[model samples]
Target: MTTGNSGSPISRYTKDRKVGEGTYAVVYLGKQVNNDRKIAIKEIKTGLFKDGLDMSAIREVKYLQELHHINVIELIDVFTAHNTNNLNLVLEFLPGDLEVLIKNTSVVFKPSDIKSWLLMTLRGIHHCHRNFILHRDLKPNNLLLSPTGELKIADFGLARAMGNPNEDLTSNVVTRWYRAPELLFGAKHYVEAVDMWSIGIIFAELMLRTPYLPGKDDLDQVDVTFRALGTPTEQNWPNVSNLPLYNALKVYPPPSRQELRNRFSAATDTALNLLCSLTELNPGKRCTSTQALLHEYFTESPAPTLPSELPKNDVAGGDSDDDEPENKRRKV
Candidate 1:
């Protein structure tokens, strides 16, 4: 586990196996020779750009190195492989994630299970916001679950620092389905509330066990969001129409919050209220992470389950747990 002049990161690990692949990098499941601890090594593809390192790689390493929390993925080490220009990121390996749990029909999710997952997800986002960093991406797939049932937020490639009012940001940050209304309207100077909206959608998904809004394109995304939560107008979201792309959106009659209740009948009053606050059209009126943590939902009946008590299937992101079909992330 030593980083010598050769800068070979693979030298310290063994039993390398490819777990996933993306446009910019490939992930491998490996173990530390010294401690036999498992790890996820992200190998960044080189020679794709004129610059030395890819921007996403740089941003991921920079922000992840600074963020340290139980709900956040841990960046163990970073080094390049010998005889190669590629850089590798050593991260704490998570067995599975929330998406897998949701897709696993074998696992029945109680309200308490959803509460536990939401609490931990909020905790992670709270940590990021408290540090003034914005996790632009927040979806079920990005919420990694450890073997102990602890949830960890992963993927910092789209994350950036907040609180700079003068800096312009791109609205096309979050994934299409989970993107906030403000971003869809082309609001450049957005805040952390963007992530909050995604969390709200995730909460809804947790309750329903299906994607609340699966849009095919950008317009369809906005259309689907408006249909579910009601379209934002000048009265609801001040200055929203002034955004660059607001004029492109078609008109939609605002639906009442009762519609949301009907859709998520499984949610309690307190839980429903929290989701409403999170998916507020107006960022100014949206609930912050701190406020959401104190919501009455946490104190209600069927309290959040203990991490160790969560449903444990033999499947833990690998085939070793052959109790079920091998769940594989085909295109993450």
Candidate 2:
């Protein structure tokens, strides 16, 4: 794939403007000359590290190259510009993300609209899990919306193959807000439920239009989680006592599911049931992505709205086609 010796993939597109910037990379809105399709180019900064490529970039490239699904972001191409100290990734340009949509108070998403986004998000995640990959980091911002309103999982930088039993993996992979209790308790050998927990939180955020557990820090995250969901007990989660940091977890009596359900009066009872399953404290019992997709909430009266007909918002990935204002650049 090393094209530095000859031709470069960078020549095929016309970069229109910068879309986003981050500590590791800069994103540009570009168009392929042959077909004029829009694309987002993420140029990874290499000068900060003595190594040639960032570890997250390596992980992203390795996994995305192996998996292809409609709900996941497409990695169009990869190459390094000869004159620049960067690794550029050409990707499908999305209009906006769920975060911007959720944060836009002026926009009111119906139950079906929320269901549609959640359905697509789960489908994308299910694809990742089916292929033995774990998306350790899952949050509203990482869920990008295509112009058609289809939700696509993006930012796989923290994603990786699942850890087998008896092997140790980092407990600190997910963002603080969405980190599961098992991860908070420092469980080394965990499963894909970690991501499911995050999905549950995202579900709650969709319903409330605010973060479910907005902890100020890791410790605060754990406290808010137990208060909002429930503290894991050995009875509820059999292996709770065995986790590395179990002793450190606060001892809060589990909150009633009904109390939590009352918070989302606008949602159907079935919706609450699905959220309950996804947010279950026990990693062993949390709803799998497939179960989520098959949940009654989807088949109930208000079926998930078709993506193209959902509410519109003006943000990156909000609009599906041309005439969308060129995406504005901002730091990720």
Candidate 3:
């Protein structure tokens, strides 16, 4: 299938089967015709609206085409069908995602495994942030896992470049559970800290095997987040009250070190430190990707597992847990 100029030939890939469908695109599991490399073709329905191409599709192509990193999903090709005129994005086919592994009751997650995943995730986002881009959505589901165990960040539709200081960004981004306190408070002038908060929540999820702050709705999200991390007051978060929606919140005291310890029983002191740094109430105080990568948690005992050695789904001839050390096995 050929298209207008500047398009790759759709005939170069075979659409094996339909895997997923979204509001504007249908994803098909496919492979490259020449090398048989697995790929996912996101067929965008360009004719759906009078606006022509969807904005998300445009953003995905606009950004993914420029990013090239091992931890980021590769945008292999972009082409339009000769007859259908549909915009198709060819992406690396990641068979699993972090959310699937986190939800699977039988699969075990060791501390090293969590560290490894977190490390890879940070590496990926560090690349993005350094490029002045924001991965506005960073839930577990968006972090896809390759067959060889490398974790690659995906779903760039919600992503955008860092805006100017005077620019106002939408606070209505990121999933409710993973949304940062700044976003909840309606801070339009936010930065990379928002993504850090999502990573903190995902880290907690890895430890707890459940969502940390599962707010029912936006209003409830405000209550749920502060209740767990303490209400952001003028002292803890300077200029917090200046935000549009930062009024009349219940004043919950910050949890003590012991309290945090009890909450995350399995986490080491260094791990807890990193979590707190990431989820700090004040956006300015939250750790940057560089600081997080340099944290003691990653360098302390029980080193991060090699990507190839990290735990994965049992769907493909599961690993022999019998030979694993006791410390390496997750205690569920």
TM-scores for every predicted model: 0.92, 0.92, 0.92
lDDT of 1 by residue, 66-164 (tens): 999999999988887677767888888777778877887999988998899999999999999998899998999899877788889988988999756
Please list all clashing residue pairs in model 1, or write none if there are none: none
Error of 1 at 14 (Å): 2.6
lDDT of 2 by residue, 234-318 (tens): 8888978888877766578876767775788787778888989999999899989999988888899788899889886764342
Clashing pairs in 3: none
Task: Compare candidates 1 and 3 on TM-score and give the better one.
Answer: 3
Task: Report residue 57 deviation for candidate 1 (angstroms).
Answer: 1.1
Report the lDDT tens digits of candidate 3 across residue range 1-332: 42233335876888867766778888876778777677888988887789899988898999999999999999999988789989998999776789878998889899999999999999999999999999999999899888799999998988999888888899999988999998998889899999999999999999999999999999999888888889988888888899999888888888899999998999999999999999898999999999999999999989999988877765442332222121111100
- The lDDT per prediction is 0.83, 0.83, 0.86
Task: Please give the range of 10 consecutive residues that has the lowest summed lDDT in model 1.
Answer: 321-330
Comparing 2 and 3 on lDDT, the stronger one: 3
lDDT for model 1, please. 0.83
